[model samples]
Target: MANGRAGELVLRERRSLGGADWLYARLRQLFKNSIVILALAAVWEVAPRTGLVNVTFFPPLSEVAAAWWQLLLSGDLGDHAAASLSRSLGGFLLAIAVSIPLGLAIGWWKPVSEYLNPFLELMRNTAALAILPIFILLLGLGETSKVAIVFYACSFPLLLNTISGVKNVDPLLIKSARSMGLSSVGLFRKVILPASIPTIFVGIRQAGASSILVLVAAEMVGATSGLGYLIQYSQFSFLITEMYAGILTISVIGLIVNYVLVTLEQRLTAWKPSARE
Candidate 1:
């Protein structure tokens, strides 16, 4: 009976040890995944305080966090954030609408591609910022101009990616669909689209990043309310902490937007192999 009791106790201890080991391994993986972010944050938190960087110009992370918290409480951040988001989403959605169909036509029709390629190349090469004055003159310093700028900035990547994706679709798949007596629209819908989705999402992700950048520039140049304007306002007033807070807010928003797009892409393309996996 004593021997049996000893065995039971040993088995319980082994189970407990196994649980602890599993938990430790999970924690280690989490740490490994987050190490770079943590390291950068630690440096940010320490550098200004240690005088390795000027504290006035570049406030410590803690001060920036405090400012962020204060802004959150004041409701200023939300208002500005919403305005910025509306502009970005408006322009991004518009770009998607314009690019997708046009890109498909360009990719599918030889005459369309021949007619549009030179114009696209010229517009794509022209810097959007360089034409800011022209946009201002044409559309004024209103929401229209900003949204147009964002649209122009985002459209090219998606258009180019979409064209490439459609063009590069496997001949075998196209021939198979044709063999099945599928209509042109049916072939495009069933085969070409599904194959091109992965590549199209790559452009979408790139456009997401570009939209944020263009929004910032637009807001900085001529806007009353936005995260970018907040940063500019804070900087001119010499509120370094608030400036950092605004910048951080933009970073967080951009990350969230990118994450959402990635999640959407993963869900939509579950059949495709994941680079992360």
Candidate 2:
């Protein structure tokens, strides 16, 4: 009985040590991955103080952190972030809803592709920012215009990628499914759609990035609320530190958005051999 208890204790100790070793390895990897960022931060904190850069325009990292904290305490950061997120997410969701279905149809149906290809080619070639004036004129310089511009910017990537995903599905997979006597709809649902998801998500990630970029530019052009507006207003008012703070906040938000999308992509594609590997 005593030997059984001793054996159990030994097993538990081994597990605890293994867990601790894993944690230490993870932390070490994190530090290694972050080394460049840490070095850059050190330079940013040092350069202005050492007069390598003008302190007036390029405040140290500490000053920016202080300004960011002040903005957070004053609730300005939250409000601006909320406005930006609402506009970007609204436009992103709208693009996803409209683009994916149309892309699938265009890719699957030769007639539909022929009918729309020319128009799509022309529109996609035109830059979204180049047509900002038209959107503002049609929708007015309100939330509608901002959302519309973001939608326009994000749509092409999603549309193009979805089309490519559908069209490029493996012929062998389709043949195999058909050999099993799968119907058109069943083949699409079981083989085509699943195969296409990774490609579709590539577009989704691109559009996600575009949504943020276009919205920031739009807000910088004209707006009363948003991180872009905050940065612009701070720059104009000569609140250099605050402007840097807003820029930093935007970077952080972009990183968070990208991380979330990547996690979602991993979850959805967990069955893929590459993902499992």
Candidate 3:
């Protein structure tokens, strides 16, 4: 009788756990993640209609939505968005390709670090936008100039973060590895590189934002076919709704890019304990 009762209790406990798991899965599947976004959209939709702001300058959300749909349907938005994406990605990738290796070398070698530090500080201090005329003069009012602007804007963040991350790797960890007779290459590969991954990702995120910002400004100056150009043209033509739609598209693109980078970071760092826990 005792054994039979024990078996019955175990079965009941298992059933309870299974039910809880099922309920959690259902909740996750049914979650409405856009509630807050929808609420903000509602406010935007209502504000101009209520005369809280001038609809001419600050068009209502409904008009913006209509414009967005129209642009999407007409396919003009896609072409401009694609052009902007190409420039942004081209410059950003070039920065990453150059910055990471250079950063690693600087962080690892005292001579390189000392040699580059002053020049880096000087370059980083200068405003990237301030160099627009120089770039246009050198590279012409072409894709090269715009892309170079993005590269200049994005490189500093990643390069600085990489140096910081590598240099900040715990000294004790290096000592430990040295005591174990690890080679210089082995120490860097096994210890310093792993420790710096998170910080490097942080730099990547910052660079992505910078790339978009600089690209937009560069487009505003000379481009005839990017989202920035679209926004500028719409504003000049007094098509406030289209301008707002372009602005909204930029915001969404930024959010999506950041979201992707964040997701990638989370996956790569899953072994680390999250603050939420």
- Best-performing candidate as measured by lDDT: 2
Clashing pairs in 2: none
Candidate 2 lDDT over 1-277, as tens digits, reads 4446446655775586797785786688899999999999999999999999999999999999999999999999999999999999999999999999999889878999999989999999999999998998899878999999999999999999999999999999999999999999999889988899999999999999999999999999889999999999999999999999999988998899999998788677766755223
Displacement of the residue 213 alpha carbon in candidate 2, Å: 0.7
Which candidate order results from sorting by lDDT in descending order?
Answer: 2, 3, 1
Model 1, 226: alpha-carbon shift in Å? 0.6
Write down the lDDT of every candidate, Cα atoms only: 0.89, 0.91, 0.90
Over 4 Å off in model 2, which ranges?
1-17
lDDT (Cα) of model 1: 0.89
Residue-by-residue lDDT tens digits, candidate 3, 162-215: 999999999999999999999999999999888888999999999999999889
Scored against the true structure, residue 77 in model 1 reaches a CA lDDT of 88
lDDT of 3: 0.90
Tens digits of per-residue lDDT for model 1, 1-277: 4446446655775587697785786688899998999999999999998999998898889989999999999999898899899999999999999997888889988999999999999999988788877888999988999899999999999999999999999999999999999999999899989899888898999999889988988899999999889989999999889999988888888899899998788667766654633
Name the 10 consecutive residues with the lowest summed lDDT in model 2: 1-10
Which of the two, 1 or 3, has more lDDT? 3
At residue 236, candidate 1 shows an lDDT of: 96
Q: List the residue pairs that clash in candidate 3.
A: none
